[model samples]
Target chain A: AKAKDFTYSNRGMTLEEDLNETNKFYLQSEIAVIHKKPTPVQIVNVDYPKRSAAVIKEAYFKQASTTDYNGVYKGKYIDFEAKETRFKTSFPLNNFHKHQIEHIKQVLNQNGIAFVILRFSSIEEVYFLEGKHLLSLWYRMEEGGRKSITISEVQEYGHRILLGFRPRIDYIKIVDKLYNLS
Target chain B: AKAKDFTYSNRGMTLEEDLNETNKFYLQSEIAVIHKKPTPVQIVNVDYPKRSAAVIKEAYFKQASTTDYNGVYKGKYIDFEAKETRFKTSFPLNNFHKHQIEHIKQVLNQNGIAFVILRFSSIEEVYFLEGKHLLSLWYRMEEGGRKSITISEVQEYGHRILLGFRPRIDYIKIVDKLYNLS
Candidate 1:
């Protein structure tokens, strides 16, 4: 089922690059308008070069952002964070931050679509877990539950996102099913 | 009526800062999830110290972003650009790039709320103009029309945003009226 043409171009691309490429395809096709927020940086010093663009001489990477991607899909607000975990047995819940968890909860309260795209890099498979379900496990962990969620647990709770030629991840198909979107 | 408390607090803050502060207030109150996208920078060089955080040694400012702010409001995706013009007569259309205009158009096509918050910095008044109205003026300009929109025209086509204490701009009230939200 793996086509040579599809395999060749996406061979060495990182997960972030792959998602960005897919997002570009989606935008060009008028399917969606998701965009990854730029990494925040605390700029300290800058030099204004004469008759040219300003050069930043000193800066530091700022704190972690709220989420990676967000946009409108079918008149509904879509927000998600993507993560790739190496462990095949379980996914470490520590990958998400406390503030990010709060952000997802807020999105749900606003009646928007909120979820996370978790990629098992070893297995080369991705899963979509709803914010509500993730929140439940997160609270359990705070209450002294296991620090990681087993692969089987994810298999039962999350939707498997099949890879495709065009948009690659095709997460929207899962979104349609999850949100009952027309 | 310039209140002493409001003046003292917001004295040195720029229009952008005021908006950001208002956004923070909105987010904290769970009223909306709007955020100003960080200024994008192009990294050139980095210094990685063994035990400390990596420092950006060289970088340059990137191109202007699509819009200044975006997020979910009342289950509807909201996208907008904020601009403050010192001109009392009209807003120079040059303030907007071709791509920004196209972005607002895309937001409209997606059934999301798309608008611009224009501040007449001199008079300390702001107006909310719909993307559709902007497009009409943009197209007219492309066809060799006026390079700027008159204040009278804006008063007719745009909604005046009242100032407030906590949220500052209070643009959401205008949003409710514009969208006819219950």
Candidate 2:
């Protein structure tokens, strides 16, 4: 799957870039409106030079209390988190935090669309798993079950997102299918 | 109004701190799940001094493309932008960006609750005005009308929020009235 037919430079681009491109495509095509929340950073010190832009002298990543991406799509609120892992066997549960899980649950209780986007960075594969499925697995994990979700399980329950030229993550098609959108 | 019985605080806490405290109160008091979106900064240079923290050496403020706060409350999706003004007569239209207006319009079209929280810092008064009203005013401003929303108009359609110890904004009470939640 990795070496079959790939010619694009996955070069200096981070996962954020891919997701952003995907969102841009979705917006232009009028498919969905989604965006990655700005990375939460705590700035402690800054230096403002006379003729230069302000430079951050010190900063730290602040723990996000909610998921990364959220927006409205076709009369429904959409929210989700995106994670990339190098491991092949499973995606680590530690990638998610307790508060984020609680937030997603609350969103679900309010009849909003909540999910997680898992990226297998090694193989360049992405899967979108609904929040309910992830929650059930997470609960089982808490009860001394699997600590991580296996790739096979993800494949069974999640939709495989094909990387495209525009809107890199075109997951709205899957969303439309799951939500029965016309 | 300046010489009223109201007290003043010059603690000079950052905007984020004020919002965090307000959100903490909101959460504990079951008011509304309102939060400031993390500040958007474009990192041009970064230094990995140690494994613990990555220091950003150079950064610039990126124009925000969406409204700051959004969440579900009482079965309705709530989206809003918080603005603080010192002017007594009117709140400037420049406080809201074009994209933010478009985003609010999208939320309204989806049947979600969209509004603005305007804070007159000098008077310590806050008002919650529906996005539709803001958009109407904004359109008029574009057509050579007043470049700001007058305090009188705001007083008419907006709910005055009396900041308290718990749930500082206390806008959820207004939400309950708007949505007939209870």
Candidate 3:
């Protein structure tokens, strides 16, 4: 079983990388315009060597308040955070931060489409859960509810994103269905 | 004249800082969700100190391929790049790159609002020039046209953004005009 796990791990690309590749394909095909926000870094010090490029001598990673990816889809604003977990039974609520939950609410208030791409990597499956659905679970957790959502609950609430060759994950196809786009 | 120039320079702020402050105000008011993309940096090395935070020891800033700020407003996608120039008579065409023009075209094709925020720093004036208008000039430049657009031309083709106290530059009001939203 461990050897089989190793094989799966070796063959499987990270969900982020897959999404990046998918976005690139979408961009080239003129379907959508999406991009992953760069990791915020705090630069403290820099060294300018004579006749050479300046080097960042000291820096630290800064916490981002928003989601990882966002862009335009069929003239609508789309925003989301991508997360992957190995646990097969359920997805732990701790994976999401407090600020992110609030951000999703704000996006919804502005009438924007916001969601999370949840990947059960061990099972090689992914699901797209809308912001409203995530908020319900988030509020439940806040009120001493279940620590995690069961796999069946995810299946019931989230739309499955089937893997593909070029896009790697065809989540937009599901978006079209959700938005009633032809 | 020199004294007057000093007075203008002393009172005027950089367009970018002004825009950041404006965006912050917009966010606080729940008007729109837009943010300038972080300057991409190529992290070369990092030092993880024991019992302390990791520090980036070496890194270099990377050139950005796309426009600066993007987000959603009124359920529609919005994207734009901002540039300020000291030149009073004309905005140099070289201020925009080839890829950025192409990117703007792509955004427009997808039915998203795309534009350039042109700031004449010396005059303390700003204008919003839409992507289609920008393309016209870009194509003209390609055909060995004038290297820049005169201030008169900008005033004729773009919407002037007046300075304000709350949001600093009221570009959104101009956007309202462009989208025919009161």
Candidate 4:
């Protein structure tokens, strides 16, 4: 394989960039208003230099308590986490935090649309796994059954995302189909 | 008045803190799932010490492109920005950006609940101003009218939030009434 051929995951862009571009497109096209929450950081120190912007001198990344992306789409609340895994056979459960699982359950209880977007980077494939499915998987894990959902299981329970140029990955189309927006 | 009396806005805690507490209470009680988005920061440089967590060496705060607080309530998409003003007579228009205005408009168009939580700190009064009302005020400003929405106008178009111990500011009750959630 040519070295450049390896860059086929949405043309060398990670799922994050693809999602950002998708969100930007969504906003511009008035399709949706989702946004990835800012990377959480714990600022320890800052310096207010003369005639310059305040500079954070000491800081650390903090784990997000909620999903990465959230917004309203067609009168419904949308929430989801996007992850890229190199593992070919399965999507690992360790990519998620316990609180995040709880958060998804809470969102489901509130009747909000929540899900996980998993990108199998090695295969350049993406899937939209619903919040309920994730919770069921978590429960199964709690029962000491399986630590990860196999790719075949994901294929059975999740919708595959079709990538495109306009919105990069058209996840919203999958969402609309899943949630019956249309 | 004693110096300690100065700490009247939710016992010296800022509106942000108060809202955070309120959201936490709501989450715990299964009333709602709102959260203040983390302060946006543009991370520039980072250092990875062998045995320590990655340290952000340089960063700067970035103006938020959307409203701060967003979540689900009674299956509705809720989004809002909270601001406290020391101005006695009015809430200034400069507290919002153009894109935020656009965001609120788009959210409203999608049939989501959108509003601004305003605190007139001098009097310790907080009002939930509807997104449509805010858009009207912004339009008025664009038409060479008032640059700020007077307190009277806020009182007319907004619902006053009662401060409470458990939630700090019971804004959800106002939302329930305003949007007929209950």
User: DockQ (Cα-based) per candidate?
Assistant: 0.79, 0.44, 0.73, 0.82
C-alpha lDDT of residue A66 in model 4: 95
Docking class of 1: medium
Compose the digit string of candidate 4's lDDT tens values, residues A8-46. Answer: 542778889889999999988999989999999999999
* Model 3 per-residue lDDT tens digits across residues B99-178: 88988998898888899999998777788998899989999999999989899989999988766666876677777888
Residue range with the least summed lDDT across 10 consecutive positions in model 2 chain B? B1-10
The positional error of residue B81 in candidate 2, measured at the CA in angstroms, is 1.0
Write one digit per residue (lDDT tens) for candidate 2, span A4-95: 23313455455677778878777666666677899888888888889977777677777898899887677567888989899987899989
lDDT for model 1: 0.84
Candidate with better TM-score, 1 vs 2: 1
RMSD of 4: 3.5
Reproduced native contacts, each prediction: 0.71, 0.39, 0.70, 0.82
Please give the lDDT score at residue A107 for candidate 3.
83
Better TM-score candidate (1, 3): 1
State every prediction's TM-score relative to the real structure. 0.95, 0.85, 0.93, 0.95
Order the candidates by lDDT, highest first: 4, 3, 1, 2
| Model 3 lDDT tens row, A101-176 | 8778878887889999998987877899988999999899999999787889899999987677777777788788
Ranking by DockQ: 4, 1, 3, 2
> In model 2, what is the error at residue A140, expressed in angstroms?
2.0
- Most accurate candidate by lDDT: 4
TM accuracy, model 4: 0.95
Error of 2 at B5 (Å): 9.4
Interface RMSD of each: 0.9, 2.5, 0.9, 0.6
